[model samples]
Each structure stands twice: as structure tokens, then as C-alpha cells.
Target: MDYGIVSLRSNGMFAFLPLGQRVISKLVALIDEEMRSISAQKLSLPLLTSGHLWKITGRWDTTGQELIKVQDRHNKDYVLSPTHEESVTNLVSEVYPLSHRQLPLRLYQTTSKFRDEMKPRFGLLRCKEFLMKDLYTFDDSEEAAVVTYNEICNAYDRVFQRIGVPYLKVAGDCGNIGGNFSHEYHYQAAIGEDTLLLCNACGISTNSQLVANPDDVSCTKCGNQLTKVTGIEVGHTFLLGTKYSESLDAHYQNEKGKPELLQMGCYGLGVSRIMAAVVEVLSQDEYITWPWILAPFKVCLITPKKGSKEEGAKPWVDHLAEYISCMQGFQNDVIVDDRDKLTIGKRVTEAKKTGYPLIIVVGKRACETVPLFEVIDSRSNKVQVLSHKLLLNYLKEVSIEQ
Candidate 1:
């Protein structure tokens, strides 16, 4: 982060540098694609909400002291919304009121949320403000609600897998969210705050908070002994049933033309938390190597030593970098280290610290003869040489594989 990927502001908040923002954009794109495939509509909700909405659902007091409330010039109450359930539910009721045809509606928003954490730590893990992707689902019946829930679970699984993190879907507690059931997606890490128990034989996992005897529990499916591991929660899904709808008076007309409470579910992914969790789990020692899809740049091309023979090919290196930047997937993402008078070792070290997936070094031999590029895989520390003519093909294949 010394390269300005993320700049620390205080105990719980930070600013995303250009590189950091690019990674977040890529992650959001992937998630947006998945959510749109499942017919979820994206919308933005206000960051500040009226206290009346919170009071309607009794969340004004039940939401705890972490909630930030403010008074206006007229002494009217407002809240820096920690969640958007009341606002969205009320909005949807006004937009599409009491229609059986619009029963199973899915709406989501990707925005910053706030909570006055008493003790915020671990950067984005526990923050007073963070980006969150919260999705709300409305269904007419329990069966339809389950279908929507499973669809969201599958989408969340794809998201984690594509991000190349080893995450587990474990049984989770509903807690104050007021849901019938919940599931959490956890990324295993030694520095994580949450403890989870896993069964190797049956692949069963559960959060320690939800288990009665987490230390001595056996897998109910395979009778295997459980192992405890620390994990960071990156995503959570709740089968809320009618918890929010009934409390907020969000009712719809059914096939019988009778008013019934919508079966509700909420899914949340900690967008900024995922960024920090990726660093926590994937960082080797102090170096950070991100997956291709989540990396700010997939390739970094470096020129040779300024005084060396390889410096003859500096123009060609610059040309190749520009050409690569115009390609479909890597547009404007090829970082060409063209700093003059820098040694090859120093340039490579600086580039390595920024965590590009692949690095290509144009050295003396390649510049003098066959014009090959020495490619280095940052994550694996593997090296390979490829000719200029084959660089695009190699990138295409790598992109397809990732």
C-alpha cells in the first residue's frame, strides 16, 4: 500500500487510490454481471434516512447505539443509514404496490454505509464507513422465496470462486437481522476475527457463534471430527421470510386477491471488506499478489537498465506497452515502467511491490537478438520467455484460463 493503492485516513477509514479503485471496479463489474443474470435491478438508496422510517420498523432503538443519528435545524431526527431495508421496502411499496405479478422482485444497491463502531480495527474489516452491496428479494410465497435464495447463493459462490479465494459457505446466525435462517461466506485467514469449525470428511462448516459445542463437535453427515479455523466473513445471506415486510407494512395482493406480507430475503456482500480480506488471505509475507480478474493491471512491462545494452530496445518496449494497452481486456492497464537511469533490479523490485499478476522484462539478450520478453508470474515466481509476435496470443490464453 506504500505505492498509494490505499491511503489510510484514520483508524477505520481509508481512501482508494487509482489502482485500488480499478480493482474495486473490476470486482463490481463481475458482481453486477452475476446479479443482472439473476434478474436483480440495481438502484441507489439515500445515505441519510428519516427517523420516522426507522421508528416504523422499530429499528430506531433496536439497531443499537452504533447507528448514527442526527437532528436537523427544526430538531427533526435523521439517521446515517447503516442498512437500507426500511427505505427500500417503503420505496418499492410506493412504486409497485400490491401486485401479484410483481411479487418476486429483486433490488440491490452498491453504496457506502456507516456505523459508529466503538472500536474499529483491521482496516476495512471493522470500519465506521465502508462500501457494501446489499440485495433485497421479495417473493409472494415461501417456495418462491427459497428459489430466489438459492439463486443468490449460487451467484455468491460464483463471485468468490472467480475472485480466486478459498471461501467456505457455513451455517450462520441471524442475530439482530431478524431472519429465520442465514448463511455466511468466510475467507479463511489466521488473522481473522471469527472462528469457524469445519469437517474435512463431509465438508460441513459452521460459525462458532452458531454452534453449541464448537470445540468437540462432529460432522453430522460423515461423523468426522471438526477443526477450528479463523475466517473473515465476506458475505452473508438471510432468509428473512416476512420479518422486514410485515414490520414495515410492505404487503402485496396474492392470486386470491387478498393482501399478504411479502416473503423477504436480504443478501449482503462487504465490497470494501472483500478488498481487505483479499489482502489478508492472499498476501505472502508482505507482498500482495491479486488474482487476474481482481488485479489492477494484469501485466507490467519494464524497460532494461538505462546504461546497459538492452537499453537499445527501450523504444520497442514502449511501443509494445502502448500496443498491449489497446487490447480488449487490458486497455489502459499495462503499466510500462519507463523511469530513466533506474537499475533493472530496482525497477523490478518496485514493480513487484505493486503486485501485478505478470511482469515482462525486456533485457539485453532479447533486445540484441530474437526480441523475446522474459515474463515473470508474480504469484508463482515462475519465469518464461516469449517472443513479441506471441505476446498477444499468450495473453489471450491466460485471460481465457483465468
Candidate 2:
């Protein structure tokens, strides 16, 4: 790919190059921060889970071909986990005894998940192996579990808001995850595969898959006509009350000192899928626009030709970047592109594609009486010619250069 973010492997798999990995790491960090705010504890799960665990919940056969099942040399059955409900339940229940105080527990992890997609396409959006952030909640009762579900869902809302995209929190089907109540977070885009019905009056959205009839359905919140929109699902939440816990006997002590099944819920955010979907929705015909926090670098310094007199401005840009890194704690937020063989025009074009929020061009202007450099604002596509001191002030205003 031009940007070197990801590449297609054999058929349904993809390899995320360094740039892609950096983007995923930023997204993961954001998700981790949001999860921790909800008092969720982080943990890692094995990529391979025992088939016996799925059998315990009767999902071993119910989960169609999408579930990737394999065998070891001993011929025992195992699964490349598509989800961790069964494994997490067994992990919690197998303990001698869980306590009431431990109820309302939240656990989460960001890891690779596997599924045997019949037809994978759209790059990382629908790949066989992808990164995901999944959170599981345990509570002493269904009421408490529902409360945890809403709390986590609110946290998810905060994340999407920070991502700076208008997303729909639509009522959705439980499907294979199987819970009575569920919601999906999606970004409406032309290439989206899922159909969403947006209410005309109250501006509510619901997944069409959950509605029995499209033509007959109306907004349940308000009696208004519904219009259809396509969307890419980026996140999902399920109020799984005692489904996994009761099936696996994951119990915690009650106030009466008796064992009671732990109510459960699960939340999922498609890490790679979101990265792709954000690009799908936000990128323009001429440029890629990443969310400011998710951009690989806040500023890219582009110097003139290697031997040209304009190249003198390179030191000024580098000195400023070094100062910002060493004094202001912005170590990896700025980069200097020293590919001087390429013309400044070509370099600027490539930097736009890389989605740098701000670009500093050190050209012949540095030799002028005022000695100014050009700053291009990708978000606004505006060019400002300012001297070194004003450039620093502008960067400080945008919170990028300074």
C-alpha cells in the first residue's frame, strides 16, 4: 500500500506494517484508558481455548463455521477464540469461591481474535484475524449487571465522542453472542454493510437486522417514519445476564451466605475494524484525515532539496522539534522527513496521505528578511506563512508544534 499501514497476506489475512501497528497502539491505549475509568481490570487470554469450554455452554455446535476449531497432535479439540465468554466464566467459577464483594467486577483485554470468514474483504474491516478489545462484567444480580452494562456503554460513548465521529448507538440483535438486550455503535458510511434505520422525528437509530419488517417498522421511542442508512459497526455491548455464569456455575456468595450465579455482560470494540472504518468515513478524495489523537505524528517537518540553499531552514525545524520533544514531553508527536531526493511538492503530497495534522515546510522563505516557514493545516487545508517565532505561537495555539 502507498502508506505502508497494512498489506493483504494469503486470502483473508493481513499484516499490519509499522505504521499500522502505531495506529492500532494508539487506539488500544485510548480504549484502555476508557476501560480503566470504568474500574475495569485488564488481563490477557490465551489465543487457543479448549473446545470443552464451548461445549459447556452448548456453543460448540451452535456457533457455525465462523468459529475456528482445530485439533492438536493428541487429537483433542480446541478453538481459536472468537470470544472469551466461556473461558472467562470457567476462569472465575473454577476458583474455590467468589465473594459478594467481588461482584460487579469488570475485566477486559485487547488481543487478537480469529474467525473463519467465508468471504473476507475491505482490508482489516472483515478479516479472518483482527485485533479487538473485549470487556466482561460480573455482578451478583441482573439489576446490577444491567447497571454495569449502561455504565460501560456510557464509557463507549465517551470514546466515540473523543474520536470525533458522529456514531449511532442503535438497538441491535444479540445474534450468536445471545443476550436479551444489546446495542451496536456504528459510523454511517456509504461502504457500510449493515443497514441502520434512523428515526425521522426523534433521531434514534436501530439495526434493521433486529426489526421484523423494514416497511412496517417505525421508531419505538416516537411514532415517526424511519429512513434507512448504511453503517459500519465499530463497537457492541450486550447485557448477558447469567447466560455464561449460570451455564458455567460461576457463582458468588449472597448476603444470606448462599451461592448465587454471577450476572454477566460483554462489550466489544473492533480495534482494527475501527481504524479502517474511521478512515472509511473521515478520509477525503485528496487527503486522509485521521482523528488528531490517532494521527501517527502531530507535525511533519519537510525540508527543501539536500543541496539547495533553502535546506538551511532544516536546522531551525529540527531544533524546534528537538526542543518540543525534550522540554514539552512530545517525543513521538513530531517527525522530520529527510527524504531530500524528492521535491518538496511530492513530499508534501505524501505527508498529506500519511494524515499528519500539521506540516511545516522549510523552504527558501527561511532566507528572507523575516525568515518565515510555511505551515499547512491538513484539517483545514489552509496555508500560513509565518516567521519562526510566530510559527511557534501558531503551533502552541494548535497544540502541535510547541
Clashes of each: 0, 0
Residue 158 in candidate 1, Cα distance off native in Å: 1.0
Structural similarity to truth (TM-score) of each candidate: 0.93, 0.95
lDDT of 1 by residue, 302-373 (tens): 887778877788887878788888877788888887785888778777777789988888887576567788
Model 1: C-alpha RMSD to truth?
2.1
lDDT of 2 by residue, 62-149 (tens): 9999999999999999999999999898999986578898777899999999999999988888889999999999988778888898
Task: List candidate 1 stretches off by more than 4 Å.
Answer: 176-180, 221-223, 304-309
Model 2 weakest 10-residue run by lDDT: 323-332
**Model 1 lDDT, residue 129, Cα:** 93
Query: What C-alpha RMSD separates each model from the true structure?
Result: 2.1, 2.1
With candidate 1 superimposed using the best TM-score fit, by how many Å does residue 177's alpha carbon deviate from the native? 9.1
